[model samples]
Target: MTEPYHIDTSSNWRRQAVEDWLFGLDHLSPGMREKVVTAWVSAWASSSHERLEDMPFSPGENPYRLMDHVNDVTRAGLDLGARAAADWKVEFDPEVLVPILILHDVDKPLIYGREGNAGVHAQLFHELPHGVIGGMLLKELGFAHTIVSTVATHATNAPFHGRNLEAHVLHYADLFAADHAFRQMGKTPLYLRHGR
Candidate 1:
């Protein structure tokens, strides 16, 4: 197990919000759960937004927030995992999938900001695509290789694809959630817009 990344979150509201999303996963070990909390805390602490919900899901004229997007992905990923397991007759590990789904966009807060503001962590936001810095952060924090790879490759334009069942499940779940958000915003879904 990796050493814990401890922080004083007694006053941080985001800590509770992060835990609310992460709690009650039967497959997520305590160690893994702490790592997820650490990731969210570390990212938000270094970010510009005062509230997690204040951060938008993507840049530009989108109304959706990062918190909402994360919730959508997590919920979608779990549902997809259950359905896929039933159909394929193979078990998917929530321990793996949940963390990857939760942390896949952990770097977004650093990369984006409230409208009209520059990226809070430009050092990383300007240097790499969406998932690279996030994956590297997880690695530096000693996340397992599978978890890191799944988070890293969950992006649509990532050069290397994740090679695990959890990664595949996360990819589709992410797309489904994104599509739902886009539809709610009255825009064409990426999958339908590009037909890719």
Candidate 2:
């Protein structure tokens, strides 16, 4: 685990940030906490770019790439989940939700070039079982089994065996963000333009 990626436990900012995030997840069981944090950090460590500007995905004209989309979706998921938790009076740890949000798309980078269209990329990556890979990554990082299972099962749709309320929230949030981004990119009709 340490060989492929190094955990910067020395950085106060990173350490503090992680702690704060974990604190939010205090509602979860100890095992869940370990799994979520491990998965979250593993995804971040792998997807982090050298420059912020290098985050977005551009077909050709743009300088960024699809990895940026992954980051954006993750953030959107966190925001949406927080709002939902507040509105529903559900006592959830933002830490738990946040990590799940972040790691939901851990395999996007690996599938980008291989699939040209967004839908195809998603389908192809879905085939690769990113959730399983993410779970393994979480385990490697010392997360608890519960969290690892949660992260791995986040993207799975219902009736097939993988669906949790928290994970579902994160998944919907990602979809919302991606739809918004598609509209922004002029690939779809903007909500306002639809005359709804």
Candidate 3:
């Protein structure tokens, strides 16, 4: 049997810091949670950003922090998923949903740089979309196909929007987070913008 991938978060300040944002996912299995945290910490370790909070939601002068958006998406997903389950009697697994939400933007750290120079490395070494990179990482780390595929297709611009319940919930949750952030910043929401 293959050994589970593990990282000693206690020894590294960076891993602990990243784990803070991932605290509320007890709904996920320990192995899945470890993989999710592992992905985030690994991305941070590979990137130029000194901290998880240093990564931005987008590449430009955007004010949204990547983790903030991720947390927002997760919360919104839970709320929406609950409502859908209660109202429409649809079934979805939180185990699948939560990890995908947490790791959906796992590539942000790698794709972006420090505050002043974000996306510089992206223009060169990281050309893939954040979703694609994240999906690739999760796959390399042995995540389930459902989780990996959902993370891969969760991007708004992804060619194949997934057909599963978790994918649908994640898609709207991500949109909800970004829309709220953009509106709060007094810019037009991405869904409302043209030439996307």
Against the reference, the lDDT scores of all candidates come to 0.76, 0.52, 0.76
Q: Model 2, 72-152: lDDT tens per residue?
A: 666666667678778987755655565666556554433332222222232334455656666666667665455567767
How much does each candidate deviate from the true structure in C-alpha RMSD? Answer: 4.4, 7.1, 4.4
Q: Which candidate comes out best when scored by TM-score?
A: 3
Per-residue accuracy of model 1 over 76-132 as CA lDDT, tens digit each: 888888998999998976677788888888888777866563223444566678887
Candidate 2 residue 43 C-alpha distance from true site, Å: 5.9
Q: Rank the candidates by TM-score, best first.
A: 3, 1, 2
lDDT of 3 at 73: 88
lDDT for model 1: 0.76
Model 2: residues >4 Å from true position, as ranges? Answer: 1-71, 113-127, 156-161, 188-196
TM-score of each: 0.85, 0.54, 0.87
Q: How well is each residue in 1-196 modelled by candidate 3, as lDDT tens digits?
A: 1222223244477767766777457777777777778888877776667767688777666667888988898888888889999998988777787888888888777666655743344542345765777777788888889999989888877888789888988888899899998886677998899999
Give me the runs in candidate 1 sitting further than 4 Å from their true place: 1-12, 21-27, 116-123
